[model samples]
Target chain A: MSENKRTEVDQLGEFGLIERITKDVEINHKSTVKGIGDDAAVIDCGDDYMVVSTDMLLEGIHFDLSFMPLQHLGYKAIAVNVSDIAAMNALPEQVTVSIAITNRFSVEAIDMIYQGIKAACKNYNVDLVGGDTTSSRSGLVISVSVTGRVAKDKIVYRSGAKKGDILCLSGDIGGAYMGLQVLLREKKVYESNPEMQPKLDDYEYIVGRQLRPEARTDVIHDLREIGIVPTSMIDVSDGVASEIMHICKASGVGAAIYEQKLPVDQRTFDACHEFKIPSVTPGLNGGEDYELLFTIDQEDFKKVEKNPNIYFIGYIDEAESGARMVTVGDQIVPISAQGFKHF
Target chain B: MSENKRTEVDQLGEFGLIERITKDVEINHKSTVKGIGDDAAVIDCGDDYMVVSTDMLLEGIHFDLSFMPLQHLGYKAIAVNVSDIAAMNALPEQVTVSIAITNRFSVEAIDMIYQGIKAACKNYNVDLVGGDTTSSRSGLVISVSVTGRVAKDKIVYRSGAKKGDILCLSGDIGGAYMGLQVLLREKKVYESNPEMQPKLDDYEYIVGRQLRPEARTDVIHDLREIGIVPTSMIDVSDGVASEIMHICKASGVGAAIYEQKLPVDQRTFDACHEFKIPSVTPGLNGGEDYELLFTIDQEDFKKVEKNPNIYFIGYIDEAESGARMVTVGDQIVPISAQGFKHF
Candidate 1:
């Protein structure tokens, strides 16, 4: 309703936008150790802290059916919510999904969505305990809620990072974002000329990252095996720079990340260069990576440093220092979040 | 996309269409003792069967800001989901809400919604455990999931009725339906001329029924106090006739509801007459009454036989008899669902 209204969501992107909206939220529940900065919300249950997280995927906002299959959407829905639980350093046990679809979809379409749901359930060792199915006047709406458990002492929160904790990232970053670029480019090409087939075979890795990103529950198990518990943890749904800043802000600390240490997959690098987008931009702000970012005490670094899966990106620092990113040339640059702006 | 073009939902009215679409869902979860028939879905969770229920309200679909206050919308959202839990003869414990709104909604709007949610939580003695706040492209969307607890033995499903069980309604019906009528009328009057007052003062009872209908959780308490566990239970959401058919189909029994014993408030009766609508028709099929309807065993009859709040409207019978209605003048006629259709 603004008179001079030309503020498009593209201006802030996705990660930048989420930060702006969630900036003012304050957690009031003692049980809620962490809220909104992680893959899942952490709560203090009696026996163990429970991790609760929810995600809503609007049809056009979060996905495109022309390229993203229905089954994968269902799978991704559960996976994203599960990723939230994993970010809390917990194992997901149960989930509830609510979907609203138009009549344009047939029973077969629903079955396919369920097939993806069942597959995800099997893959993650979770129970599809409950959900609601209703008709949507427009496009499909999928909302999922996941619950997981972790020992009270073992639960990780975004606000627990200390000045000297080592920052660790599980798996690579920006592959999903790069994959989305590839998919969008191919779609544009196909739209321009129907006879042109998408050259997707060359971009399989990045494409798969966009289509079926996995939640890193295995990392939680591996962390336990290596006797390393993160002091603070969050999932990389909104890229590393944004997530790191989230931990810094919530924990009342600062973070400094070395750009050269960021784990970027070869395919993502190739795709980013092909698309003419700055590789660092995608690595820092492209959302939906679904990787784990955590901070561990300096002593715990020895346990996970040798693990190929864990990348040592940076370290937590005093709050007054502020969050920053060190470029490849050793110059520290202030980080800016271009979080996904769904509005 | 069907070639045989059907009328749009807006033409059918929200309630009318919802009733039509939800008519044929088959409940398959044995844990789900009851599904859409009740205010909430009932689950057989070990020592205590849990109640699970969800409600999704799209901004344009379910409410309008021109008239509906955000606080009330939040309260109604929780109340509706909680009512589903109460319908299963359970006490609600926790809830998860997922909200999607455009940037047009301020942080203050979000806070107001949370304020209402917190108020409902305190009033219902439930926990504001978890939720998701995300961006919406078009309108606001709120989806709530509630979890409630009831003893395994006390938990009731819609499919538990048997021959000779008494059919009872917890409170008067049709008030909400009439209240909606009054609000709609006022909304139209105001739309036609912006200066017109809503004139809701004289129609407080009906308007309250429409805007702030209460879930009959107290009825569950009363049943416990009198030691009268109903043979079957369901929340009156889609009206009496539709819910009765659902119970009958699920329990594989038939019922005969007496017309004379149907409870209708004086105001509701007067409103129905004023609108030239049959009073019994609205009482029979008007949805959103938020009353508890259940079947009780003959042995427990003595416990609630004299309770003024309870209305003994009918009795369950053999499946072969089919569901029917006994007219005030003694004619027995087959009962048909004339409930709200939401699709």
Candidate 2:
């Protein structure tokens, strides 16, 4: 720590910080097929390639308990990590969940959280393996790491796409972001008027998206069954824009996504309109979607072209072209990431 | 969740809490051979078994950053998780670390912590495969999970011990606890007078023991090399007394540990004496020893009898006899566990 070299994390942003931090990391093990720059790290474990990914959720920083139920919070933690494994086109086999809670939580409260965790495990067919439960000085903290397995040939990474690949997205986006908007608005309303009930009935779909987002494991299975191999893949965690940028930088190819092709749910668009937020903004940069963003060879495009669930939104191009979006007015514009900032 | 049946975690203690929490857990995956009740969960990955263990370190709850360096905290976090794998008689191959830090932490501070993590991974020959870094609302929190592998025949569990098995403890104990006392004392002295240079030179070994403890993986390697298998094993993260109780309960046996045979470092003994704490109490009840406690077949005792690092402290007996200890003064006392309570 030199006195003159204090680098603020904000100046570098999350991606920049990760780049600086992982720059010197060396993979010494023969089994470690991949280290960073992927949805999950890949390890060659004899018969199968093990995929490992981790996620940490912090109170206040990541979620507000006033809007987030403990059970949903627990499920979301597991889902997010599982989503990472799904991005690698792997089947999640085991997960470890570590939580730190303050004394304000009772034994029953903890059990409620575990109940959701157990439910998620059963739903995803993953075994809850090992973890640490400890006391926290302040708020709740949950960190979950999941391990999955895939055949060596089936594994996908963020750095495998080439120029002329088609960018595909699994399912819709912006619902979770819109759901967060509704929750925050309701919270503010409730805070001001203690007697009022949150009007969540009308926004159930979007709210559900925020509270209980499922990992795109189904899409991974579908891809496998359809015999489609993703050239490059990542989860839409930070946002479509940021994640596409990640794919572009890692795969050394630019992408041109069409804004008109973006799949924003009806409820999501209505919620955005109701909240006075730009309709396209939520789909483009609002995060926590957990959808799969992948690139496929142009030859295999026809296989998924008619699939209702799969949306073709972009095409890979030369690196010098940069990541951009083709708008409805037939104008091409550069895509700049405005993902959630914690700092 | 019934209102009439509120179970407090403190009443159950840590192990009791664990048992209560995991009692109803159902393993849904055929790959998951073992979920809980061991140092690491075992998943049958076709040709080999993958063992996973997780550990969490919280600020104030786990350690005081005033005297503990970020690097040592990082090192200890990895070492503790590795110790769990060693307890399973497995070799750690990969690790995922998740960290939450407030903006108060500079990139340099985070780098120091990662430096320690990197050093530990290098020392243990494990790959730093994946991790998550996020902003924390309060203090720094680090959670690490390691995956290891062991032969099916050689994997040790806590329920495998038989009556008359010789109990062995690796290396010395109580040094970490004594080191903590010294650090606390220095902190108090520094608090009282800002300009005072609190003495720490003489207590280097004990203080180092508290700040940075190594896992007893060497003992595991030695035992494997000697073709001696521990019937039951656990890491002494809690006090030796508490861990022995766990082994006895799991194995359905009684233990007779001799007080005179307990291993204690000279510096630890001196520190205990200086602090006017019972010398035997520190050796038996002090936590963070990071030593391996195991029971071996009596036939295998001769192989380790000449080993300097291994100390034969007791023997297993029938369950009806209960866990008891023979004092140096020739008094037979029933064993009591006053384990470290993180809550």
Candidate 3:
């Protein structure tokens, strides 16, 4: 960098910066079927397509250890990576976890973390293959990389959606975000009164959602069992509104979601009401829901119509129509969300 | 953890902790062929085996920004990961890099780092497939994961060595460690005298080894062309003695290295003299020299005998003898080195 020429990263935003940096990257191998723009990179591995996904969780950035338990943090790290693999319609077979932590942490503390990691590995049926562990000078950082395989014909990408496809969601949203708010509120209460025991019984469900989220790999299995492949799919890491926009943009189509059809659990709704937050806003714009956001052909609706877990929220439209939402009061509005901005 | 029980991480050491943590990990998938130990994890990918390796570099733990350039750091991260794949006798095809940095980094700063990453990707013929970028509360952190493939019959593990295997090394060692000493000394001189410039002209070769060490992947290609597979192999990351011991323990054999045959470049030798360090100490105990250390059967020695880059350094010994070194004075002594300890 020149002495006088420096541009702040925020000017380009995260997506824009990634686009500019990766735009010129050249692919050198034929095995690399997909690169740079999806839940995972797809590699052609003979009879099947191998998918690789990576995620990094930093202390004070992705989680606060004061409230987040070490075991839960480890489980969440694996779950998030497995979520990406599930998004590709693949079965995660192996994972590599690399962690850097300060000496302030004890071996027992690290064991607690690995106990959580081992539990997640067992739950997801993924082998803990390899990883590098080293000491850190600051907060703990955990980075996990997962590899999975899918039949070549069964692979899914975010660019496969078409007009008239039905948009679907696996489960409820906004619980993770609302759960974080409840934890923060309780933490503040305890910080002020040393003798006060935390009253967490009422917020158990939401808090559990925030602390430990299971990747929706079971949904991928269900889709395969029902013989229904999603036209396009992406795991909701950033919020529903942003994910809808991503699918629409990638597929060169548009989406119109119905607010009344949005799934919000009763606990999440009650918490949002008590917190004075708009009930629908968290589902549309909140983060870390880790649910499946996918599209399927309208003809395949019968296969999922009887399924209680999957919710039909909307439909894909023409490219020029843009991402939008139909309110409960019967009005169409364009959807724009300030997706989670870490920068 | 119990309220009254806690074990400090230092007591168990890195390897002991890893062993205890992964001891009960049961493999759930048949695709996972190897896990937890070795330079890279091996996965059965039908006709061939896919290898996965991961590494994490923390700012204050692995590097110092004051002396290490961001571009070189990026290049080194890729090189080290590639080295792990080469140790498994696989051809690296794809890599994913995840980084966390504070807002203090400029767009240009990140661009510089990517420039080096792209350059290394091009140099090594590996594709940069995908990665995650996030904000950090403290300093910069980079974690890289690489995937490679090798034929099932061609892959070599650290436990494949025989009693008569000849030990060999690719290229020189100790240059990187000496170069680091030179840089640190110059940094101190500059810190004490603002107007003084770093005298790096006389130490360019060693300094380059420090800043931009290349993975000896060409040797892997050379071995393939010569139709010879190593009995066992590992990269010299924690110095040669430590890596030799790893192979010995894993292979259930011992090694006898010749002190006179140790390779040290002229600049590294001069720097070691200036630094008041024994010439052989850095080669034995200093770190970060990414050279290949392997064992070849005696019958295959004729193939690499004419290869200038492959230096015959030692021979495999009986397990009862342990790892030993033969000095120039004709005395043999057991070799024990204090490897790089991050904690």
Candidate with top lDDT is 3
User: CAPRI verdict on model 3?
Assistant: high
Q: Estimate candidate 3's RMSD in Å.
A: 1.4
- Candidate 3 local distance difference test against the native: 0.91
Give Cα distance to truth, residue A210, candidate 3, Å: 0.7
Candidate 1 local Cα displacement, residue A39, angstroms? 4.3
Chain A TM-score, each candidate: 0.91, 0.97, 0.98
Clashes of each: 24, 0, 0
Fnat of all models, as shown: 0.10, 0.68, 0.87
| lDDT by residue for model 3 (A1-343), tens | 4756988888988888889789999998998999999999999888999999999999988998879999999999999999999999998999999998888898888988998998999999999998988899999999999999999999999999999999999999999889988888888898999688778899998899889998999999999999999999999999999999899888999889999999999999999999999988889988888999999998899999999999999999898999999999999999996685431
lDDT tens per residue, model 3, B1-343: 3855888878988878788888898888899999988999999988999999999998878888888898999999999999999999898999999988889999889988898899889888999999998888999999999999999999989998889999999988999888888888899999999799999999999989988999878989999999999999998888999999999999999999999998887778888898899889988877788999999999999998999898889999788989999988989989885676531
Scored against the native two-chain complex, candidate 3 gets a DockQ of: 0.86
Model 2 lDDT per residue over B191-257, tens place: 9997988699999998988899998888878989999889999999888998898899989999999
lDDT of 2 by residue, A185-231 (tens): 89999999989999999999999998999999999899999999899
Candidates' TM-scores? Answer: 0.85, 0.97, 0.98
Give stretches of model 1 more than 4 Å off: A1-49, A190-197, A225-227, B1-50, B64-67, B103-115, B151-154, B186-202, B225-228
DockQ head-to-head 1 vs 2, winner: 2
Candidate 1 per-residue lDDT over residues B291-313, each given as its tens digit:
88899999999999999999999
